[model samples]
Target: MGREELVRRVSEFAKESEETILNQVRKMGSSLDWSRYAYTLDEKRASAVSHAFVNMYEAGLIYRGHRIVNWDPKGQTTISDDEVVYEEENGKFYYFQYGPFVIGTARPETKFGDKYVVINPNDTRYKEYEHGQQIELEWINGPITATVIMDEASDPEIGSGVMTITPWHSVVDFELAEKHDLDKEQIIDKYGKLLPIAQEFEGMKITEAREKIVEKLNKKGLLVKVDEKYTHNVSKSERTGATVEPQIMEQWFVAVDKPFKIPHSEIKGVKSGDEVTLKQLMRTAVESRDIEMSQNGFRKTYFHWIDNLHDWCISRQIWFGHRIPVWYKGEDIYCGNDAPDGEGWEQDPDVLDTWFSSALWTFSTLGWPEKTKDMETFHPNAFMSPAYEILPLWVSRMILMSSFHLGQVPFKKVLIHGLVRDKSGRKFSKSLGNGIDPLDLVSEYGADAVRMGLLVGTAIGNDINFDESKVKGYKHFANKLWNITRFILENHHEGVPKTLPDKAIGYLDELKHIVAEITTEMEKYHLYLASEKLYHYIWHRVADQILEETKEVFASDEEDAKIAMSHTLNIILTTSLKLLHPFMPFVTETIWQELPQKDEDMLMIAKWPHTKD
Candidate 1:
């Protein structure tokens, strides 16, 4: 399909999917402000993206550079390193005779681009070869000259203790080339076909070329030996499932290690005049306790990622995103929010990476780039709850962008939740046909039941093995709660007394302790513990014990005892509903509206119950 038509169709599909998601959220009774809803592709967000690009470019943090990237050949786009999925696969390791050294490589197809033979400097086997010594190597295409270089990155324990450097096809090779200023040759095209440099193997697929080249190398007496049981991790594109090709491409990148002056002094010890790199800013945000994670292990993960950070590739070869705000007219190239003030200036065809816009979500959604009330109030969001899979992709980029622009972390605390898998502990996928439709679950049991079932036994940062039996059980709990509310309303007297009766004082005190414990768990971001506590307290303690005991008081003739019993029931029901509201909002709110003594019009906005000292 044509690019424009494809973008149009994809956009329509995206809008429909977005509306379906919003409807499901509303059905689940989420208390989000619909009026302030913003889309990444909306005009305001587009403006924010463009503004950010221009600002970063002006600050020299964003630049066009030739660097190695994970290129998705099927998608015809450059994806970030985090988007690459590595899977262990069995392959052959071929050892080839190169002049005096025998080098090992798994990809003989990429050998056509070999620019250097790398060896460990400490390896005595290669001591005769001095650094920068030119050597003639036998090749399928004929004689090729390669320089010998010694570096510790080459493992002396590996096969042959030496390797050929294919700079255009490998990250380590590219880094070595950059360090030594060596030449790079591109042997693979964007279409994954061998380039003309491969001679007779030109235009052949990489797999086809590998077989053909290996056969020709064996005939030329250059192939040493092949280990058929070589197993290694191969990088593949998460979206297209194609093996990712490491290619050097000219793309826009955010220089994460480039130092820049802090624009704001809101972050502690990071004054406005202080200079820091994006990596430093992100590390400081967590190390200084400015941003706390729900799990301590996630903090370590965040720091490890930051310490090994690379310049971010921010451009994509896609049509349905914010087009890069760069224009070029002949020799004049401009990076700005708008096109150059002249004719014949064509804007860059590539769009910014999807995550580039998503990274600006916190501030851009609040009308950033222009001082606004929402930005001032919500720039440093108090809490962020996102799936753990995005800790490096979406979460880290958000931190990097926010620290650079706002000079503060995006959120004070991040609760990293895990994915919900099938009951068998396998990830739900289309191939497995194990994906559960949450809306169907909501229709079958109810939103509240499904919500509570999801939270009941799930721990922080742990994957949930969803079981429909749990939802069915929670559905029964909802019905029980409804029955308890009905019994309380039917048996209670006219007024809710200020104090608990002496007989029910013990229940009141127990409820107070449970409330305090639940509050503490919620404060620590332990939603699972909070949900379990609420379930047990409402079902066993209140329904089985207190409600059954109060029946005796209702049957008595003393009006004051019945009144005190009713007051105590009222406090228990209202407090329990408030505690459960976050997990089971719909049912709790519905039951709250039926109660005669509620302080707020909406149960969602009611004051959280607290324990008195």
Candidate 2:
């Protein structure tokens, strides 16, 4: 169904139930095509996700492994970087003795006793022990052992003069585990558990266990000393104010680039898929960042977000998304890993993050996980990624994903733009009461007028403020187009003249230049520029020129006026509709219908205009 019909149906259903996302989508004029809409929880999407995993599995890219993950326990899912929220936290640092050794920690009450004070092999202070051995750690009160790992971050002057390791709770611990090849010390598990070595603490509520263990340690005289006043930074759940527990859990994972390779020749011409070479991508990512910095358009210093990139935790411990396709037959785990398997083992309950599958959306939504015609035609647009709000997260991931999956960049160019901010240069937020309800805008000014206004002075990667004045200006432009076409229909004859009139061809050079300029802007993804150029031509140049000279023609000779007026009007209407199609689909389609040259045909499937590519 088309947008209007879908909206109508949704509106009808919305009235019959409690208001929900569907109601909101309808209210917002999302214009969804219900026939094509698949909920994240829908079977179609789940099957597609399963198919993707199976293909990757057969290729040996998907694997079950232990890795550090941004875990969201309340949501009970392993979240990706995009889903993680990092906020500043105030915490206490406790200094205590573990037997003979002194250790400082932020959580002396919980797993702090689980802390292992590691010393670097190269450090002259601990050079007495075997370079990699975990000595019996006899602290001031208790006995423990920990393998040594290298880190200059461990200051010799810190609390208890030692840094302890809890691989399951801290990223530093996991890194240390990797460095020393510590198996029992690894944070996550083969089956995914906190390990029975944690003693009674295993499977216990982390915070509650911390308190219980601390009390027992004090009773047993394992607690050496306590510093209640020291403050430090600690990890806290962003979604919830509770302290985050880095509990080891059994979760599915895909190893990053496990023996993954691309032959140099096979890598060529791959834009958005599996054939794109790592070398090519490193160069592109570097170039994109460098250009962004030098152009003074983007934030100068984005934190090194990818420097320590970890394996993406694709499983979400939630009911909302595509569940991981693998099924467990008592930990033997039957994965469709190679082919289409159906109807037996229990499917993994965890769902893929909305973005995990959406990273594959450009193709998945176009029938990927199974190739189709749209995929064949539009697989790698030699042009650009069309939207802007998705620049960092969705757009960037799609680019890399397309390269990794299809051996090509998804698109040749990335067209990025910022969100629509309000007049005070603040972003539109509900809390700020600054959001422009697009549907309200549509009702007040019409879709075409609003779209044109949104583009007027907008530039790639720049915020376009939503101002009433700009919308009014576009509304006036629409009115001008309407009035001009109405005048032509009323006064001019239907057919082109047998002989070309001198006046009609008089402005041909200028008209061709306008076309050339607009085409160039569009090809470069400078769409706002294209819109501006069109507006200037239509409102000021063409219309103004006609108003001035056409009056002279009408006064002197009626036939001369009719030929120039009819020819010019047709050109304006055709060009304007073409220019407006990507932004204002409905209004441009309506205008196209009112044109004398075309029959009734939907503009959505109309062949996109050609550029001098």
**TM-score on alpha carbons, each prediction:** 0.97, 0.70
Candidate 2 residue 368 C-alpha distance from true site, Å: 4.7
**lDDT tens per residue, model 1, 1-613:** 8978989999999999999989888887788888999999999999999999999999999999899998999999999988999999999999889877788888999988786888889999878888988987677678888888889989989877888888998998899999999889899999999999988888999988787899999999999999999999999999899999999999999999998888786775577989898898888887887888748888888888888888999999988899999998888889988777979999899999899999999999988999999888887999998998899999999998898888878999898999999999999999899988789999999999999989988988899999999999999999999999999999879865667667688878988999999999998888999999999989998899888888888999988888888888888999999999999998999998898888898998888999982
True lDDT of residue 281, candidate 2: 51
Give the lowest summed-lDDT range of ten residues in model 2.
294-303
Off by over 4 Å in 1: 495-501
Candidate 2 — which residues are off by over 4 angstroms? 1-44, 89-111, 118-149, 152-162, 182-244, 260-265, 269-307, 337-345, 365-375, 381-412, 421-436, 486-506, 543-545, 557-562, 595-613
lDDT of each: 0.89, 0.59
Model 2 agreement with the true structure over 190-285: per-residue lDDT tens digits: 322334555655665555555565666667665666655655555545455444555455666555535455432223333332443333453354
For model 2 the local lDDT of residue 265 reads 22
lDDT of 1 at 182: 88
